[model samples]
Target: MKLLHVHSLPLKDVIIDLAALFKVDYTRNCGEYSVKIPSTWGTGSIKGINFQGGLGLLIYDCNFNTDVEIHFTVNDIHPLKFLYCLQGKISHHFENHTDEHPLSNYQNIIVASKGNDGHVLKFHKNEQTEIYSLEINRKLFKSKMACELGKAKPNLQEIFNDDLGDKSFYYNGLYSLNLAEIFEEMKNTNFDHLIGKIFSESQSFRMLTQQLIQFDDDSNEDADRIILRKAEVSAILEAVEIFKAELDMLGSISSIANRVGLSGNKFQNGFKTLYGKTANEYIQFLKLSLAKDLLVNTHDSIQEIKYKIGFNSHSYFSQLFKKMYGVNPSIYRQNYLENKKMNRSQKDYK
Candidate 1:
């Protein structure tokens, strides 16, 4: 979508217009607000409190302001987001993603898929905040970056590290400055030239993403060689898929080791090196994910669900579920159902 001209309108009007264009539903009550938007054009739902404004970056008058909390419910499978915080703070809660380090005020946080959820940020208000958001399309970015790097799959982590370098700062603040500078420059430049600059930078970013992916792949290969005598990243990945398919049978480390033709110690260490988790840990993760799905989509009783997922005891399942999700399974299910009801009621109001 072409960036909408938002120079002179009231903030609320601008927000509403943008929401409409994006097919998002929003309500502003007091200083607190709420927004429900599709994570992508066609699918996924992101619901959150727009305490000041919803989660995303905004740039106005060279300053940055982002104060919104977005709970990514569906279709947000990737880890990177480019947001412009317009007026308030924003906290992002991740599902299974973690940051390598805390983001500096002007750096970006690389989202790791294996990381935990609940990653968040709070952007303070700034009158001069005039921000724009760009949610990087990972597949597209990866493809384009790979072309630039001359690799089929590149390491995005290293690419971002190299590009941002010591200048790394929190993702929001860094992008705030970059975007503001670009937008300001755009205002003074010819339209064609402005578009050209954006496209060039975008292409550069794509290349950077690819490089990082390649770096990560190489890192894995190196680590794998140290533990497995011979590195077979592809085979390990295949084994992981197989293990996922028969998660219930993965109770023993020996079974996993035998499948990969390695001794128990080698398999354990190699799996951790390649995938960042032990065999049992990975199995538990699969089980947790399955439990989450069941909690959300089915009416199965907790005990029944636990037994089905190979958890013999209800209390143990509940504890593990809470540890991972921050809420018990029953509560999680209840909350989801309540939200669904609330959404329906809101729709009826409209």
Candidate 2:
């Protein structure tokens, strides 16, 4: 399906038009909107909130049956975007480039400037795309921000200073769990009441704050100096998928490198550059994170969880868990259970 000329319209109208084009069930009240498109177009739904002025949030949980393309223009005042793709891939095409920028699972991208002409958004068939998008008006941000950028914990002065319409300033990396959870919370309920509105705006601002802080940690000012070949990056991503599928296997560096047709040194270096962690470190992180989830969400023993993640040594597992989270696995699980109980109690009292 093709959606054209969506630029120049207000965001609300734009989304409404999109729903109409897809023949989806669309609803809007106050500033909150939800669209339920046909399963052929996509499954699940697309939800959004368009706040006053120029702040907006959109969440997509979908799998398209065929490729879909969106080409839209932007306003004269450039809008910045924070996009986190928790799953699947999206391809973006700019007017000036023959190539398209692909955003895959766990990837976060910041488009600091909207380009001059229209841009394209392409979604592929059978890809389960889960994405969170936040749009900010740069001019509004500068005017409304209460503090000076120079004194902020995360310096975003460089982003603030980029001339409007310059798309050169972009940052991309793995989407942290912190960001994923914040957006997930926004989607788990309907924030339509007065108190809900206040909470929604607060969460939106919090998401923005976290994005800036993450941007500070992940930004590369000299991207030209350290660029990975497309094939290399693609191979590394394939390796990542392999790791995800076989978290318990803990494949050797050379094996993964050989599978991807790269020297061990090159694979390690490129993995570190793209993911901000060595290949081994990334695998360990995934295992530990999955273990933590199982601990909190399942009624499994610590030993079982350890073995599930392929850790044979209990001492080694506890040591790594404590080093990363500052708590033992059992104690961490207990704390999580207690906190959950307390939250339930508080809600009952209310």
Candidate 3:
């Protein structure tokens, strides 16, 4: 394990220090700092940007050849970090503590060290890891917060309300569905530099808000804390089959997810990742598809079709069917039959 110490403050300098160790130069655009990995070390890139009110984001997407540990050993206080692992795995250790915390894919950890204590992040060798860190300089952020920090839950309030970074905080658990969507958008969106910065800063704030809400939800003693797992791919498949077979009487997302040994958030995320739709959305799609098939192939009335496909109201079903297909269910059926007859006549004449 190679240890590279970073003795720097402010995000851009830290990236500069890191790139210095890499013996490469990084680009500084507006407030963003970015550096690409050298071929010798492996592949990928590291990017960091600091926004107003002391909020910042650091993204590390790397596949390293050897295990590397980057130690943030600044004499001053370190920023509160919201660490999210989207790909492989990484670990965290506070400067003064011997115990280490592992952060795997689809997991997040919120940590803030008191005073001058540092943070150490370890990246595994040959592991393709994508980790995003939301770094908050508490002293500056406390004054810039738009909402009331007091309204937050006790622990959260203490962490965010601390302007001087006197208190230390650490929490690790499953992130929220909203955050997952935001992360996807941040990664996939393309825009000009000005618009990109604006977009990123806005998304960064939203990420902070979602993380705070996630922390609150995670802290609720009654809430179940379950991270989505890659092994649960089978569970998602089972869910799809269940939805297909039970479209006529499909239950709520909660019921369906519970039936598949996952939480609603996990089910929604996994379903979105694999199938590009939420569980509820997929269920609706199945119902509509069955309705369409039965409309053309069977003699069931619209009301009957509605009931057969688990829609509670005939008018709602018709409205939704028209909204999706650009015509009401009755018209859709008539059009299908008309087209079918015309094709049959043409074939017979031919």
Candidate 4:
């Protein structure tokens, strides 16, 4: 494992410097940042935007060739961070903490501190993790609230006041499915330029508000415990990745369970509990989503796509596709083409 220590740098500079140290191609434009790490390190790109008024938004979706640990030491104020992991695992251990905080899929953590604060984060090898993080400067956030709403509202006051007004605090919990869908939609959108930036910035704040509501809610304390062991959870998530990769072969649940060293019943129940859907349903959802993408983006015929994705009957595939997307495959393809052409014409006219 490779370890790096960063001392007292702004987050943007930290990322840029890290990219160079890791030998990755990095880009920044109009406040948005992107880093394309090589396959030897992790074959994916991390991209997001950082805005003024003390807000920083980032998304990390990658699988690394080796586990890496990065430790941060802040010489100034500690920023409040809301970090949600969607697909893999990342561990954070802040100063004065004995044990690491493991954030897996669907889990979130909030961190703030008054004194100089720092944390150590570890990314696992060969596991593709998708994480979205929002960081806010505490004083700037409060000032922004006062300027926009005329005062620091009660809830805002409470957040900044919690832990005896100490800025350094930690809250860990799970986020709702609605929040996950919003991120998914944002990731799937094709818009770019000023329009994309504005939309992303707006949605980032919207997500922040929603996250803060959940962060302060008292009901989250009673959330159910995850029944599966940590090893089981890791195994199941790996199985999910395999399921998506080999959809054409249609791997059976029993096979997946066997591979993961879990019994079939435990596998099914545990998977549903972790992912909020049955294994079959999730796989079908993936299939339909891929089918839609092929329909819109590829020249493959509906029948060909159906056959390619392991569906024998065109009618059966069409029925499921319509149920999921509210349109049959052919119509969906037609509308996608029309929209593309119209967009082109509008851009040309402009």
lDDT of 4 by residue, 159-278 (tens): 554422355567777775446767888889867789888888887888887776555453323223223433457778888888888888876888877887767765786788788999
Looking at model 1, report the run of 10 residues with the lowest lDDT sum. Answer: 47-56
Candidates 1 and 2 compared: the better one by TM-score is: 2
Per-residue lDDT of 274 in model 4: 85
Q: Model 1, range 192-269, lDDT digits (tens) per residue?
A: 444644543443344334323333433554324233422244456767887777765554667666676655665676
TM-score of each: 0.36, 0.59, 0.77, 0.59
Best by lDDT: 3
C-alpha-based local distance difference test score of model 4? 0.75
Task: Pick the winner on lDDT between candidates 1 and 4.
Answer: 4
Clashes of each: 44, 0, 0, 5
The true-versus-predicted C-alpha distance at residue 201 of model 4, in Å, is 0.7
Candidate 4 residue pairs that clash? 112-167, 112-168, 113-167, 113-168, 114-168
Global local distance difference test of model 3:
0.85
Give the clashing residue pairs of candidate 3, or none: none
Model 1 / residue 17 / CA error / Å: 70
lDDT per residue (tens digit) for residues 1-350 in model 2: 54544554455666776687777668886777777868666676777777764687777787888777766566564456777777789976654555677789767777653456555678887888987778776666666664675566544876764446654556677655456667678768665578787888888888887777656654544222223433357788899898888888766877987898766766776788788888888889999999999999999999999998989999999999998899989999999999999999999999
Q: Cα RMSD (Å) between model 1 and the true structure?
A: 22.1
Q: How much is the lDDT of residue 280 in candidate 1?
A: 80
